[model samples]
Target chain A: MKKFLSLHSLLSLICLLLVANNIKYLFVFIMSRQKVLNEVYYEPGYQFHTFLPHLKGVEKAGYITDLSVNRESNDGAYLQAQYYLAPTILELEDINYPYFIIDSKNTDFIIRTIKETKARRLANNEYGQALMKRPAP
Target chain B: MITIGYFLSFLLGRLTLDRCLKENVRLLHPCAAALLALVSGLGLSALLTFLTFVVLDSFHRPVIILVNISAIIIFLFFNRNLYIQKTIIPITDWLPWTKFRWFHFLYILLGVFIVGVAYVIALTHPYGEWDAWAIWNLKTRFLIVSDSWNLIFTDLHYHTHPDYPLLLPFINTWIYCFSADNLHPIPMVTNIIFVIGCGGFLCCTLYQIRKFSFPFLMGLIMFTTPSYLYLGTFQYADSLIAFFLLINLYFITMFQKTKDASWLNILGLSLGLTAFVKNEGLLMALILMFVVSVYILIDKNNRVGKSAVKHLLFTFLITFIPVLIFKVFIAPPNDDILPNINTSNFTAERFQILYNAVITEIFHEKWCYMWIVVLALLISRIWRAFNRENIILSIFFIIYSSAIVCIYVLNGKADLSWWLETSLSRILFSLLPALVFFGVHLHYSKQRGAHV
Candidate 1:
């Protein structure tokens, strides 16, 4: 009985429970690995990779998104876009830069933002994302 | 090319470790030495690469490689005689595997599965979670593309946390030096290495100190903690900080046992490297240095002496030179905490909120009841939790947690709930491994009559 109730036995029990509890994470990984590897999990930002060529030599750009930055989803998209199109700084909500990125599901919002900012659309990934150039003041 | 970069880093680390602990080389378990070498070597390489960027005023791959090679050459030259003496041996020979029991084999199997899961998670999120792409890897991208390293600190990029330390980004940038384009796998692989290194270091150190089952259990608990694996693969600097903190604790424990000044010096170096991982790491390093210094000064029984403090401080300051330069000269002011500090921000309600959040996080299912077990163990033997060796860790943990609370309370800029919800888990995650290590030591010290 003492051997059965030893510290090692107790710790082993805890370890066993821990492994049993976390086994779902492994299955979760297996289920999601293909989607993530295929960039389906990150498709919103993955779509912006094509804009890299257009963004070359661009120092700074403006960013406009329909979703508020406070939401986790919006922040993820904004940051991922920034990551994919780096070297070209993405200033959120300010369209005063030479170039700006439009990341939003709302088609009218993108059109209105570009039209109101007096920016011409330079490139668009055809998936509700675009790069626009603002007219110099 | 990336392999070459990692090889250079490992060689630099191995050689430097040999030189730093030449007299004590044989005293160290070969596995532990190799783990320390890898981490320290990666750190030194990052520092050297940062220095090269500063001197050249740009990211020059050739110069970066040249500087690293030069450092390796210097260490090799110094360690030439030690190598000739055949002091270093293969890690496989360090342990007597013939005497292994079934439980040991079970632990090994579990360890392998945990590591495999971690790698799969890393591969699944090749771009890492939000912070990895947004802050760390984003900064690396800017450094690679821009002519000036100061681009990350520009007023326009303040949202990227311009004031945060650049150790992670710099390490990624060093790997990027050998490639034509920014590869996503570099940071992924780097994070994996750090994760493995942290677990490996913990197990090997425990094996060295107390050749028993506790080491394997501590390691299993570390890897099996769901949040630890996720955060590690998330490619955040938290894992790096965790590794450095564990390294610091190991050095401290060794110093206490051996009373060797070299251990103290290595501890100093590790603390200095810790300062570069993140702002929280800087705070941790300062707190640890103070606690250890006080212990050295006041502990009459240990008799570590005054000179030992100087050795620690000097080595720490020497390795900390790059961090000092980066913080003072390059990085801009921290807008989050510094400007937002107000004494009026402190209140009873804030403390209540913090207390509630901490308690909630402690029992959160993400940790898989790991902390619950640790808390039970500590409470069951509360007195044994604060021995001479554990006191350093205990005091450090208390002060660091208090400091974190103060920072949250004093900063009115970020919404308290939002801030806590986003960051509190990762902060606790970073402390998890150290806490586990402390608990294992506490248990072993009690069982073995406090020798540990």
Candidate 2:
């Protein structure tokens, strides 16, 4: 029994306790494993973003567009990228116009939302860009 | 083929230079060699990428791959004299199925379960945690795209962390190119390799010194550290940096044990790679240099001390030059730090707040058992830890922790409390391997009645 409390055993006991916690972690992973809740198609002319050589296009489209989505949340970098990398120069009144730059791997919800809003689909091969016809009132 | 070349170059380099490997190359265990190969392979790839970027203005895949292959050839040529026909230890050394111990079966069983769970955890978030996609893999997207390496350094929204080091990005790019631009799983797979490498190195290296059971448990200790496991799967550079730092200490400890100067090269390479992996790595590298120099200078043998210092300086210079180029010629100004500091703001209240937050975060019972284990080991081994050999290691840890605290105090952004709360644990997690190393050594020293 004295051998049971050797350094390795003692440490292994702590590790056993830790591994017991993996059940919670495993549940989290299993719960969120399927990220795509809907199906959608590309908007056409969406060649993969080779690079953002210029922000003129994003600027012309307007500010505050919804960016990429992974499951339920919007990609936070979308706004930061808009602000720092490609600041919009559109009229202030147009700022309220809804738009989205979807990731190539778009969920049906995002596409359905776009279709519901009757947004003009601009580009949609790999990386997508869309402009909503109606702004949120 | 080019990816394999990076692993080969590291194997050749270590087998040639590392005295531990050289002397025992025949008896050298397979798992240990594999772990070393993984670390060295990633290190060489990062080094080659950094060098290629420095030499050429372009970031084309053909050119980068060519440079990596050429570097491998050149490395082998330079170290050709050290090559030998020694055979590595057989697979049976690692997996001796003939011996049927109940504990061994349990160990193997537990290992498989843990690995399966970790893989599932990794698969759960295909893109990895937030920063993996936002920062590291996002940079990979830039690098893999034609003519986008420039965008990495562009004033584009700093959300990509433009000032961050490019090792992970470049590596992901290499893998992406090799996989024919199959972008989806490569980054995730790369992160899994890092997790495997970190855990494998910890287990294998400890097993080499202390034998199987304890080291296996130690690996479990490291793997079970929530932050280490979580971040490793998340594609964060913190796990990669921890791997490099751990291996760096492993080599240093080997040098301490064997008085083998060749171990210093491995130490230098690992530390240099650590710096290339993250900005905090740069801080850790500098602390190591200062601490090592002091260690060399304080030894009684003046002639050996002077020679050792010179050798260490050369190693550091050779290893760190790429990081110097990347920092100087590339990388945008870091936006994380406050632009200006008010000397008057360094009040007792500010100190208390910062100190209290860090201490609470570090010592708290949830998700930070690594730090608690480290504290417990230190408390138990206080008298033994004050020996000559551990003095340098102790100084390195003290100065490194203090440097981190100072960085938080003086240069933290506007939201100091939030930054400390969110990042302090992750940053501390990068040093978890070192903390575990100390605990391992303390235990071994007591067990063997020898100074580790």
Model 1 Cα displacement at A54 (Å)? Answer: 2.7
Provide a comma-separated list of chain B TM-scores, one per candidate.
0.92, 0.86
Model 1's DockQ? 0.47
Show where candidate 1 strays beyond 4 Å: A1-44, A64-67, A70-74, A103-117, A135-137, B86-111, B209-212, B446-452
Give the per-residue lDDT of model 1 (tens digit) for A1-137.
99779977776676656656667665664685666666644522677877788789888878877887763334566777877777777888877788888878886887788678888877778667788878888
**DockQ of all candidates, in order?**
0.47, 0.14
The model with the greatest lDDT is 1
**Candidate 1 C-alpha lDDT tens digits along B281-383:** 9999999999999999898876668878998998899879889999999988788887998889899998888889889998887777778877765666568
* Lowest lDDT 10-residue stretch of candidate 1 chain B: B87-96
Residue B27 of model 2 has an lDDT of 32
Cα displacement (Å) at residue A71, model 2:
22
RMSD of 1: 3.3
Error of 2 at B25 (Å): 6.0
Q: Please state the CAPRI-style docking class of candidate 2.
A: incorrect
CAPRI-style grade of the A/B interface in model 1: acceptable
